[model samples]
Target: MRAVIATEPGGPEVLTVAELPDPEAGPGEVVLDVAAAGLNRADLLQRMGFYPPPPGASDVMGMECSGTVAAVGPDVEGWSVGDRACALLAGGGYATKVAVPAGQLMPIPDGVDLVTAAALPEVACTVWSNVFMVAGLQPGEAFLVHGGAGGIGTMAIQLASELGAKVFTTGGTAEKLAACAALGADVTINYRDEDFVEVIREVTDGRGVDVILDNMGAKYLGRNVDTLATEGRLVIIGMQGGTRAELDINALLRKRGAIIATTLRSRPTAEKSAICASVVEHVWPLVAEGLVQPIVHGTMPLAEARAAHALMESGDHMGKILLTT
Candidate 1:
């Protein structure tokens, strides 16, 4: 198997492709012949030594991949060799072959191809679990997500809009904002110039949003609270803007709002399985009907992991970036 490994804690230059031993399926697991891997911000964090894989998991830098089952281990059911799937993973996606827990695999939706399927698992699971399952966004409500043109943002915008919520998003560039609008974002704000909180408030006529899917952690915490409608819910999944911001408990109490912070990578297998099941039951139908779709910005050979990482870090791409094996 050929896999991308980090030589040390550093920049994209530390990534290199090398031949490595093929992984085998363990109990309740399966080995996949990987078709493609999705590049995520977490991968870059792992490469820079800011994030590390959970205990008893692969150290490779990827959180999801699309592939075929090559081997199924004992205790696994409803799967066998030759099955095609896209999986949410804890690690080890940047390779020609990788092992995954059986419960993490999700069947590809009707209109999606193998390589593009690689882009769905993480974003779909992340957005579905956080925005709907946790935040409980309702139809006819208002919702906002930061970084609207990125992988998770794209999926969140489409799904929220399709489900009848008015969608709001923030982007740094015109092209990115326009791309987001094409995907169903109702209000697109340029975070570089306009204030998202103010824009959202004005758009809703002084009533803020009912739910917010925010990745910008502490930097937006206060404003996110200020942007919330009474009894609103805010779900935070990333800390790209830094962690540890002060909270205005009085304001939150006054509005009766709730805030939640979570991560998909560290969840137990059973929880991930539940999230996958809900996604298949709820999200997949929309995807199959073409109400929601994967937004792939580009693809590169697996060996070009370094370039992919650089491109993702540059933040110039509008959607998911895939590395094909």
Candidate 2:
């Protein structure tokens, strides 16, 4: 098998494709002949030595993939050899063959092809768990997501809007904002030129938004609180801005808001399995019905993963970047 590994923590140039031993399925797991892998910001962070995979996981850089089942281990049922599936992985997706827990596997959605299915698992589970399960976003409420044109943001906007929430999002350019609007975002703010907090407040008649899905962490912490409606929920899933910030306890208390910071990669396998199940039950139907879709920017060969990483870091792509084996 060939896998991409970082020689050392640094730039995209550090990554190289090399021969590695093929993986075999363990109990309750399945071995996949990977068709394609999705590129994520976390992959870049791992390459730079800022993020490491959880203990006992693979060091190869990838979080999600779609492939065919080449083998299944003992205790696994309802899946078999030759099945086409996509999975959310803890690591090791940038390879020709990888082993995954059977519970993390999902059949490709009705309308999506096998290769494009690679783009769904990570973004779907992330948005569904944080926005609906944790934040409890309800119909008719106002929802806001930062980085509206990226993978998670694009999925969040469509899902929230389809479920009856009035969606708001922030992007850095007109083209990005336009893409968000076409995906059902009711309000789009250019973060480069406008204050999102004020824009959100004005759009909602000063009541603010009921839920906010944020990726900027410390950079937007204070402003996110200011933009939340009373009893609002704010979920932070990324730290592109920084990790530390001061909180205005009084402001949060006055609004009765809740702040939660979370990451998907470190979660226990059982929890991830449960989230995958929930996504299949609640979100897959929307995708099958054409109400939501995977937004992929482009696809590259697995050996070109370094170029994919460079593109993601450039922030020029509008959606997910994929690497095909």
Q: What is the TM-score of each candidate against the true structure?
A: 0.99, 0.99
- What tens-digit string does per-residue lDDT give for candidate 2 at 7-64? 9999999999999999989999999999999999999999999899999899998999
lDDT per residue as tens, model 1, 1-325: 9999999999999999988899999999999999999999999999999999999889998999999999999999999799899999999999999999988999999999999999999999999999999999999999999999999999999999999999999999999999999999999999999999889888899899999999999999999999999999999999999999999999999999999999999999999999999999999999999999999999999889999999999998988999999
User: Residue pairs in steric clash, candidate 1?
Assistant: none
Q: Please give the distance, in angstroms, between residue 33's alpha carbon in candidate 1 and its true position after superposition.
A: 0.2
Cα deviation at 215, candidate 1, in Å, is 0.7
How many clashes show up in model 2?
0
* Per-candidate RMSD, Å: 0.7, 0.5
User: Against the correct fold, how does model 2 do in TM-score?
Assistant: 0.99
Error of 1 at 177 (Å): 0.9
